[model samples]
Target: MFTIRKATVADCDLINRLAQQSFPATYRDILSPEQIDYMMDWMYAPANIRKQMEAEGHVYLLAYNPGEQPVGYVSVQPEGANTFHLQKIYVLPSCQGQHCGRFLFEQAVSYIKSVHPAPCLMELNVNRHNKALHFYEHMGMRKLREGDFPIGNGYYMNDYIMGLDI
Candidate 1:
């Protein structure tokens, strides 16, 4: 069985590896190689991830299998009062199609709701063309905005900001 739990410093390297392996597959067609590299470096570097984990307003969770190998992760940061932004959600490609992504999402939502209460909103930005957008919508997230955000190095992400009120 798969289990979801809070990430720790020891899990950073595994999370970085998972990010490196899973990111290219997910963003290769939607983003340039340069952009992918930049985002991965900016977002998934072990130091950066550790900083987020140690930050006051961020929560990072890891998913593990029966053998306790890390297979997926989700990161959330406070956007404002009563609002949280999903910084990233990634599942190892080998683990896809098994409802692991949905399971992580539901677990993240449950965590946020329990911790934040007050009818907080959970938000995430998805590449407009990513099939995950449909999954998010199907999971009851509504598109709140759509726009292009430059991801540096002359690359931009055409994305939809999706939100779910808990």
Candidate 2:
């Protein structure tokens, strides 16, 4: 069984730890160790996660298995009057084949529908080479454009911007 819950401020530590394990594992073959380490520290530092929740209005949903272990998590940030940015989504490496990602995504969509209740757009950026593009496409998101986003420290994320109408 699986359960999804809205993350609280106290969940920062858990989110940090989950990102530490999931982020690197997911990108192990695609990113260099240095880049992966840099990105993890940039994005998932406990302080950053806390800031994202408290100050930036990012909503996080955590997925837990029946054993009560967190299996995946996703963060969404409202970007405008009608657009929500899917900032981060990661499923534990061991849990990838179980459709945890799709479940988490559906939960996100359901939350938006409940809270926003208007014609909305959901947007996300995916690394150009990530195979998860197929999953997003299957979920009804389309690639709108591509951009090289600079994340400071001389690193850039080359990504495809994808969008889904909600």
Q: Which one is best on lDDT?
A: 2
Q: In model 2, state the lDDT of residue 110.
A: 88
Highest TM-score scorer: 2
Candidate 2: misplaced stretches above 4 Å?
none
For model 2, residues 10-112, the per-residue Cα lDDT tens digits are: 9999999999889999888888899999999888998989999999989999999889999999999999899999999899999998999999989888888
lDDT of 1 at 159: 92
lDDT of each: 0.87, 0.93
Q: lDDT for model 1, please.
A: 0.87
TM agreement with the true structure for every prediction: 0.93, 0.98
Clashing pairs in 2: none
Measure candidate 2: CA RMSD.
Answer: 0.8
